[model samples]
Target chain A: MDLSLIIMQLFSGIALAAVLVITALGLTIVFGMLGVVNFAHGALFMIGAYAGLYLASLTGSFWWGLLLAPVLVGAFGMLIEFVLVRRLYGRSIDDPLLLTFGLSYILVEGVRIVFGSDGIPFPTPPQLIGVVDLGVGFFPKYRLFVIALVAVVLLVLWLMLERTRVGLIVRAGARDPQIMRVLGVDIGKVWLAIFGLGVGLAALGGVLAGPMRSVNPEMGTLVLAEAFVVTVIGGLGSIVGAVVAGLMVGICISMVALFAPEMATIVMFALMAAVLLVRPQGLFGLKGRA
Target chain B: MPVYETKSRPAGLSRRKAMMAMSAGVAALAMPRLGRAADDTIRIGFPTPLTGPFAAEARDQVKCAELAVKLVNDKGGIGGRKVELLVRDDKLNAGEAATRTLELIEKDKVHAVVGALSSAVQLAVNEVTRARGVIYVSISQSDTINEVKDFSKFTFHEALNPHMTTAAVARQTLKKGMKVAHLVADYAYGHEMLRGFKRAQASIGAESVGEILHPFGAADYSTFMPRLMSMRPDVLCISNFGRDQANAIKQAVDFGIKQQMKIVVPVILHNQRLAVGADVFEGVVGGANYYWGLETQNKTAAEFNKAFRTANGGAIPTDYGAYGYSGVGSLLQAMQVAGGTDTEKVVAALEGLQYDLTKGPQHYRKCDHQSVQSVLVLESKKKSAMANENDLFAIVANDPGADEMLRSCSELGHAT
Candidate 1:
């Protein structure tokens, strides 16, 4: 491959990594701290896209949609946590997994019933519609925006987790929920907030992805599978791991797809399998805490 | 893959005879309600994807089917029996499609079945409807459905198959000695499309540069875009559908592949144009089974378009909805000629059938039961040139169902 081709593919891989990282962040955080599988993560992501699309349509601005979709979806996520997921927090992992799986189906079908099955056009803003020449070759301006936006999100998330009191509590909860509970921090409320945060992050990713993809009902399915792969390969509950793994998976798939397009989807699973064979707890997973 | 199983294809067309015997016995036992006398209503079962990836197209199909039923019933019904539509959500699942086909044939006792959107779903339904000797009018585009090995006496495909569509597209667009690279979806439909293009290219003298079989629903095509751009082919033939097509188009534009090569979409869907933007599709030549813009040119198309728009709250219908309308209309025409819902008589009546619908004249090719109609070759105008909401494609060529546009029965593996 030529130098320009390599540069373009690497850039594309970075754009893909942006989506994968944002998408997996929510699932990883929820699974890491609450031990809830959050199978509805994908559905939440789809709902976010729809929400953003509708908001963009109503306001006639992609900016407003970006500003509001996450908050709206996050609030909705909290509602779901309060109503459905709250009861099964301390229960067997199977119960939450099964419940969220059902939720995922319900959300997908519900969207289909209401909005119909066709994908609505989510256009990139005119300002971001063209290409950006990067000394060597042209790249999509929208993809560059996606990369920047994801970086800001990751940075904000890092600061929130590392610099804030709530972030410390969350890290503590992930390490030992019983200790946090014993310390009189209403664990239930913390779980609810964390769930909402995770769901909101997924929605944010969905909104970001909307312009780059066809926002249909099943749009979430592909991303959901990829997020799961990212989570597993990165380490189940590690944010740092999700970020690292997301980039790795993205670059690997991008490089492979360049040579073997047929193996792009399968390669992620293969990567996950290889990672598991080498490190059962994932690259950043705690010992005995799959 | 069990979800895609049909009785005639239990082990992928092997053990066909044994499975047919088993299916027939089961159908005989389950179809106790088949003895219902010619009732006050004629039921047509429509199994479509109401909750899957193709749900949007399926909804349009269901609407078109309902409109057809309304038109027939409004005309005092076929032989004074009101047409009742038994619509079921196939969910685009092959297993579910089989079950629904059986349910419609047995319990609901639909006089005939119509409306399967997906190739896989239709293939699965074909096995059951064929075994039960029930008439199945398919709107899917699978060439295999009409093949002699896969054919059933009772099945009729109303939409253009991959070969037909690609042949029309290639003839309209490809010039001699043009370099072509195919970014085909890695699936049966995509393979069929590539085969059709290669077949057409053979006659036209177009040179094949390279081909990439990308996974369907791939999240990104950045890698493929640069590699494809590197080949520097004259034309990039995209043989994918739905979001994959849209995603590829968006990314291709992002990667500046559009500036390097001409992008040719064999099957340009309405939703795709909107998703990828009209600007991206500008000046690109392609073909589709139908487009609502035809209403301005053809009287029948005009009437259907007006009625559909009114019914759908100003939303114009696309070629997909055209399939649903024509499929049901053709089935009803056969029933009218047969003068009853008797399966054998209806089948015989439809053997050499011709009908005029949205397009001028269309007919079922007697050999493979594939619908032969004019494929509309269109060029997407610039965004600024779009006159109205549905004014997207500028019809450049209305290639009729000539000998070259359609493959021979032997070529389609349906030799008598």
Candidate 2:
């Protein structure tokens, strides 16, 4: 009702928006380039969080945890691709999704068994502890840092894809893998790189999420559904669409919480339904991609 | 409920015979001991959650039970027999609990059983115990465990039921002149607490605006907050558990609802304060069966608390530990009084027997087989009010007698 309260809520909404955009980025990139849906992305995200916790706890440095979480998660993804996902490369598309879905359970329950089924406290650093004062508003500094950090990661990711030879090759592969192969590009390495990149994005999301939420075994399972919805609404292969849609879903969810709080989660799903109804290919998706 | 279908004690202490044994004690003394060992070990089955959310609370209960067994054996073993604790993990699931209970009774041949946490699991196990005509000591506070279920002749509740817990908290809140609304988990304990609070709400001239049933294991409580604040109730009676309780309170704080409405948790939210931070938990009122910092005259309770904290490596919920210790403790006393492993006499002796609590100087009311003692009723500590880290609680009220607040065995109707 008050000016200050609404201002704070808006800031909170933006913070959540940042997290959503970053999470969806990984999935969107994979869907956009691969022409295959990856159901195990959520599980990859969870592995990143646990890896961060385990390694950080062992090393006594949060920064190391943050840096290595994505790498370890990416490595795990690489392994999964090698042992299992590689087999599905020439097979039906649904097989990959089904394999990943099964893998997700194994990952979730494996972590539960390893960690002992309980939520553990994963604290933000003392430097990011207090509320940062904005002239007419204030927000949790760690959350603001998260928003800023993810934004930087997104910028760097865009640069890597747009300003590099690898990006050019990947874009061509996305257009037509056969044409790229005809042009003498090594498609195997490109596929591996794309898989690794997708997993890295999921890992980044997990690392970013460690402090914001409880570092429990099933933390990623909670957000898996919303991440999928964000991918769909943004268009499976559209990075720009995933970005806009993630923020859209984020702000919409927060705003919905203001009035019908319980329905906030359902609001995201409803938004996806509406988007699909309006544009089956998503906001920025290609007709051919569908 | 699995029916192993052991032959019932033939000359039955059928109410007609039970009425006769209550006074005479002659046939009961002559009653045979069904299960006894050459090593003189009488096993008490502990069907508890050792791996889930109940693990922490249940672990304390288990430790306390172990301590009680040690104490009983030290003071000349129960009826000159050593007490063996048979622990089976039920995963806090109802079906698992029932299956484990049957395993404990039939395979393990445990004479008595102690179940910790999980109302559904406790209820399920209670049925199995009744059929086996074996003693059941349930540590869960759910009232339906005592009120709705067919309590076998062998069942004896060891802790205060939900009615006793909520009614007392309701009276306390209403006495301070607060209008109330219930924010509960959509489960048995939640429903029972709401009913008891509603009854007390009426008794104290307080009104109920409405009830909001939040799903358990909720990650956020933004939806419940607006309803709580919109209702404009003086007190929001929360009977939610673990993560839901933490998220609900934290969201209320973040959304600026805490300043708008007074929050009242009927049952204490265990281990959540530490998770959410002590400052965030400040000023929310709730009732717990026991507090780690009770500072009571009961040396055993004091020692148990100190020992548990030393062993647990963190703050332990006193309620769970007390129930666990007392469940095994009472059985040991019954066996001791019976002078052997005689089921009928041990059951007879335990029916109306009360233990001198090691935690506090109180008695377990033999009437409803519920503990008659003080409860930890405190508002969360504001940083400004803190005398020390452990001194977070401001003991509002001790627990009421079980018979006074709880529905009795006869009132709950019969199983046998």
Candidate 3:
């Protein structure tokens, strides 16, 4: 294989990995603290993309739409928590999954009605619209921008989770919600906030992803299953694990595609199986959670 | 909400009467005649996607189907039987389509059934039609539908298989001295098309430089743009459909690809000329089985277009409109030819039939049950800013109605 071609493949792999990282990171925070596996995260991604596109059309600025879309989708997440998801808390594991399963349909259908069933135009921002020639090879600017943007967002999320007061409260609550509640910490409010915060992360990922993927109502549904596969492979609830595993999965798939194009999809599932066999809880999962 | 699946029908007497008696016991018995007799009304059931990802295309198809019915009824009912449409929203998913098909077939007991717009949907409904023995005509062009292992005796299609266009285009390209090409296909449908395109190219002693795979909703073409430009083939044959075609075209232009290469797109992006400004897609060549812009004195085309514009307020792509038109028109014509709504007879008639359509003339081959119709070769003409339309494709060549590439009935996986 040519060295330049190898470098090109890596470029493509890393760009794809950025998307996976953003998706898995959002899933990780929600699972880590709340113990609620929100199956509807994928639908939220689709909604966020559509919302971004719609806003862009209305405002005539893709940049403005990108910024506002996440906020709007985040608010929508809070509403979901308050109205539907709140009731699922403190119940059996299957309740939230089942409720979210039904909610996915509703969300997809609702989006279909709002945006039309066809995929919407969420054009690349003018700043990142064309391909930029790296010294070695040409790379799509939007993809490089995606890789950089996701890296920044990941850094910010890490800082907020590790350094901020609210982040401390969230980590503490995840470890000892009972103790925090005994200390009059308004545990329910914290749970609501945590849930909203997790979903907001997903919405944010969606907004960033609008230009990369089409904003179709069912687009999220396809990715949701894949994200679950990633979550299981990465070790549930581990942000660092999710990011690392996302890149690992992306590289593995790309490398496999060089030889057998059809097996690209199967490679991810096969890798997940191998990971599960090696460490049932995943690469970074705690034994108790598994 | 009804959850009408394709299996709900039990091959009841209504269906039996519909298959046998022309207008006697079924209608006079007042047993809620499912299939209306002549002068009464011929109900054509449309199991379509009205609440899912395919809603836009499916909705447009429904309107076109409705318009086709109106045109037929208005110009004079088909063999004196008024065309009545029974439409149900199938949500565009395969499982739901299967379920809804049964409900429509059983509850409505339509004289004949028009199926889902997607090839996946058609595959699912094909099973139901085979089982219930209901005459089914789908608008989907998935060639596999005709060759399914268990061919449905009752199902027929007005939509030409992807193979036909692929083979036709490849032969044309080879004849035009464009040997080396690049293939950018839109996954499954694109893959199916590529199958035929590759086969055709091999026969002509030519091959593609490389193939590029893309998921259906891919928005950025900058990645594929370089690969296409680098390959620099004589022709860039893209196997994209619908909105993706327009997006790919824009991105290709941005990359300055079309400036150097002859671009060929299969499956005209219906209403794409209206979506992206025409100036962007000008000079590009694409193929279509039907073009609304074709000069035709047929009242059917005029009425259908008028009603569609009144309702949709947008240009209707020939794919959805023509599919719907042929689906209803072909079935009604077959029924008229058979002198009754007999599923077996209509199926037989549809197997090897010829009819004058909104387009000049068409022939449905018995071999693969594929439509052998004129393939419109159109080149995007430059548009003036004062115009209201998005594209003006200058008719480059009128490939005469000929033998469309087809799978032999037995070689095909079709089961009745």
- Model no. 2, DockQ: 0.12
* lDDT per residue as tens, model 1, A53-144: 99999999999999899999999999999999888867899998999999999999899888876777788887898888877677889989
Give per-residue lDDT, candidate 3, residue B33. Answer: 52
Report the C-alpha lDDT of model 3 over B1-416, residue by residue, as the tens digit: 12233235456647664544534543455544533432366778898877654566677677778777887788777677677898888776788888888877777666788867667788888888778888888788675666656455676767767776666666555543444555454566788877767777777877578777655644444445555555667777777666567667766765556666777776655566544556556777766766666644345456555666776676544656677777887777777777667777778877756776556667666655667677667777777622435336666666767753565555674332
Higher-ranked by TM-score: 2 or 3: 3
lDDT of 3: 0.71
Of 1 and 3, the candidate ranking higher by lDDT: 1
lDDT of 1 at B263: 85
As a whole number from 0 to 100, the lDDT of residue B140 in candidate 3 is 80
lDDT per residue as tens, model 2, B1-416: 11122224356447675555454554343333333433468788998888765566677678878777776767767656677888889988989999999988887778889875878888889889888888888888874555535554577777766767777777667754566777777777777777778877877888888777765565545444444555678787888766667666765655455665677887765466655566567778888877766656446557777656665676654667778877787777777777766778877888757665645544545444555655557677877887766666676777644456655546666332
lDDT of 1 by residue, B1-416 (tens): 22234544546455666667667777775555555434557889999987766666777888888888898998999998888888999987899999988988878879899988777888999999989988999998766788877788898988888887788889887889999999999988889889989998888999999999999767577778868877879989999877777788777776778788888877887767876678667777777888888877888899888888877898888778888999998999888898879898999888867788778788888887888888888888888998986788899877777655677778767655
Q: Is candidate 1 or candidate 2 better by TM-score?
A: 1
Interface RMSD of 3: 4.4
TM-score of every prediction relative to native = 0.91, 0.76, 0.83
Candidate 1 docks at the CAPRI level of medium
